[model samples]
Target: MSSLRAFVFRMRGGLWTLLFCIILALARVTRLSFLLGLPFVILGQIWRFWAAGSIGRYRGERVGAEHLVTWGPYALMRNPLYFGNGLIGLGWALMSGPWAICIFVAAFALLYLFVIIPHEESFLHETFGTEYQDYRSRTGSFFPKTLPERGRLTGPFSFSVLRKSERHTLWTTLGGTFLIGLKGFFL
Candidate 1:
């Protein structure tokens, strides 16, 4: 892993984590627009679970990948985890029901656009070179659409990976949810 890129990712990861926690706490406190936001949160969690499973199943690393994962969710979205995370953030903001949260969302998007994404892309370009370029050319970075057309990937979506990765992601999501719920009650 490139030290610079890794550092940037870790820093941004911390920021996002903090933002998520704060939003959860506020949501729990204010009750906010829990009705409208809950759906996005649920959808975010579901997407996160799916993306995490895909990553764990294929051994994807946050730093960058060892082998190019061109099957499963990766085939559909070049950056499934980021997309899921974005959804989660957007959902949480909606739940928070504040202009500040919208600003936070916009800032987060900017961070990803200017800092995190570019760093990751440079690393990928350096690491995977042409192959990554080809994949990027064909795949959507944040929105999943169609799988790569070269060859069809087959295999039943395994519950095993889901079971394993969910331990981490699910608990985190549950914590966030509880915090939001508590905020709602207090509000």
Candidate 2:
């Protein structure tokens, strides 16, 4: 990977957090838009929560999975975290305005497509070799493949894992929504 790409892979989480803050701070929520986007946000959170519970806590500032999680949300997509992020971002954008939607799509494509996903894919390939390749082949990055995935699933979900790693996301989701709603209705 290029130095720039490596740097981005390292900073991807912070970047997304920054983006989420920007989105929340600038969001122009309306009842209609908020209602429309609520489902997406809920679904995204559910997805993220499930993924966090399925996979173990993120170990360090590196792209290494302690175990290849191939059950639960992993069965549906290769990058459930990113997929959920996309959904959340899209929902936020939708709540914000049309311009935010455009910005979110562009940023998502640039960050996830060009930098983060590729780097993570490389690392996963290096780490798991054929196992990851097979998993990659079977699963879509954001969704499941057309064909049914038939196999004995591994790895059970754990709420403890979710609590350890994902409370911030939950809190942010709740706080952001509250602020947006408050701003829309009262502020």
What are the per-model C-alpha RMSD values against the true structure?
A: 3.4, 2.0
Give model 1's TM-score versus the native structure. Answer: 0.78
Backbone collision count in every prediction? Answer: 6, 0
- Give per-residue CA lDDT, model 2, range 10-123, as digits (tens): 888788877777776777889998888778888999989888888866534577787678887788888888888888888888888777787788989999989888888888
Q: Kindly report which residue stretches of model 1 are placed more than 4 angstroms away from their true locations once superposed.
A: 1-4, 22-32, 56-62, 144-166
lDDT tens readout by residue for model 1, 1-187:
3575567677875677777866655553344466667777688788766666655463333665666666666787777777777776777677676763766577777777667788778878899989999888877887655656664343235578788756766677667766666766764
Candidate 2 Cα RMSD after full superposition onto the native fold (Å): 2.0
Worst 10 residues of 1 by lDDT: 149-158
Q: Candidates' lDDT values, in order?
A: 0.69, 0.80
Off by over 4 Å in 2: 147-154
- Which pairs of residues collide in model 2? none
